[model samples]
Target: MRKTVSLFAMLTALLVLLAACGGNQTGGSAGSSGAAGGGEKKTIKFGATAGPYSDMVTKAIKPLLEKKGYKVELVEFNDYVQPNKALANGSIDANLFQHILYLKQFATDNKLDIQEVISVPTAPMGLYSNKFKTLDSIENGSLLTIANDPSNLARSLLMLQSMGLITVKKDVNAATLSEKDIVDNPKSLQFKPVEAASLPRTLDSTALAVVPGNFALAAGMDLTKALKLEEMAENYRNVIAIKTADKDSQFAKDLKEAVQSDEFEKTIDEQFKGFSKPQWMTGK
Candidate 1:
């Protein structure tokens, strides 16, 4: 009888131990699955040029991302080169200051595998001058400054072409435009290629300067007073970029969603005050 009782007790304890082990195994499997399902990454670092891009992220995108349980860190850069470098080196998870053309050119030139996640508002380039109020007011042989980087230099040249100040070859692609591409210069406008960030500061010295929209805004130039404004196009619209490998990751998707949300649209409208127009909101 005692042997029978001992046997029964051993069987119950064994069953309990087996159940406990099974529970542990199930819990472990669930944890693994949860991670695979993209359990929240605690923080994401976003890089941007110091100005409107950084401002928008802090005032609008940051709060929205925080609501999704992500701690968003906004890293501000002063130049065009550093933001992409930071992104490439993983110092930042993503960047939001460049357009498709510039990003493509930068990636190709540097051999970096970067990709755009979403299109943001555009700060259309503007021709600003301290010496002249209108294009007609400028004289022949006047000095003009433009961005030196290939992408923006091309864009600036195209803007000059559009203003009837110069003309490029009909078959020439705007992205590949250069000073040599200027087949006609009616104004005899001498060109000086300067760093994009310095164009605003050059206004005090140069006869005229073609300032990027963000830099113009930073320097408090009146856009309405610009001699000419570059027409906004899809390629010119600024975008959010990430590593090509992370383009489809959950974090990238979340960022896309956040920027495309109605709340973000309203925030941009209120804060940017038409300094930039959201391409997505306008159905562009």
Candidate 2:
């Protein structure tokens, strides 16, 4: 009789131990507690460039990520260089500030530990001018100002090449182009590689100015005002990038899902109507 009573007590203690272990592992016990229900959850760190892009991450993406069981902490940077550097140094898990071209150049030029993981949105820069009402109005010998920065220079010149203003050598690298790179210039248009921000200010000084869509929007010029543009839809494969080592992980999956959420895509459509679209919000 005494032996039976001791066995009953032992069994009850074992059952209690099993229940406690389950609670610790599952974080979903009867009363609710663990790493989830009313318990501490994991976190994800991300960085964004200053401007509307940062706002999108905070207001749209962050909340969606939180819903999927991640505490998203986003850091904002005013300059372009820091985000990639930050990612390289392990300061950030991912960055959403650059397109594939920008990422490629940044990774190559700095030899940073990064890669172009995926494209988020494409910003088709345009040739904006307040002086000349139309492209045809600009004289052939007229001078045009493009961005001097290597990254913007390539994009600006590419737009010009597409519009038949000039032609870059087929063999030349797109990111490190210069005046000598112009293989064909039948129009006799002078090319000036001025600072990107100065391009708009030089509208009167130069016959034409190649301005990025972001700066154009900041300058209050509509897409209709541009003399020429890339056929790429606004939100074409820009990119959301992660470190080279993190390409294969569940964290990458969460980041992808949060950025490509239907809710986030709607914000892209409404907020960046001409500046971006959601057709490129895809990938595994």
Best by lDDT: 1
Superposed Cα deviation of residue 279, candidate 1 (Å)? 3.8
Tens digits of per-residue lDDT for model 1, 1-284: 99999999999999999999976543222112111234434577889888888998898888988787677788999878988888888788889898888899899999998999988876789888889988899988999999998878988888888888999888887667899888899889999998887899998888989988987888887776888788777888889998887776777878888988889988877777645565567873
Which ten contiguous residues of candidate 1 have the minimum total lDDT?
Answer: 27-36
**Which one wins on TM-score?**
1
Q: Give stretches of model 1 more than 4 Å off.
A: 1-38, 79-82, 85-89, 109-111, 173-176
Task: Give me the overall lDDT of model 2.
Answer: 0.71
Instruction: Give lDDT for model 1.
Output: 0.82
The CA lDDT of each predicted structure is 0.82, 0.71
Q: Cα deviation of 259 in candidate 1 (Å)?
A: 0.9
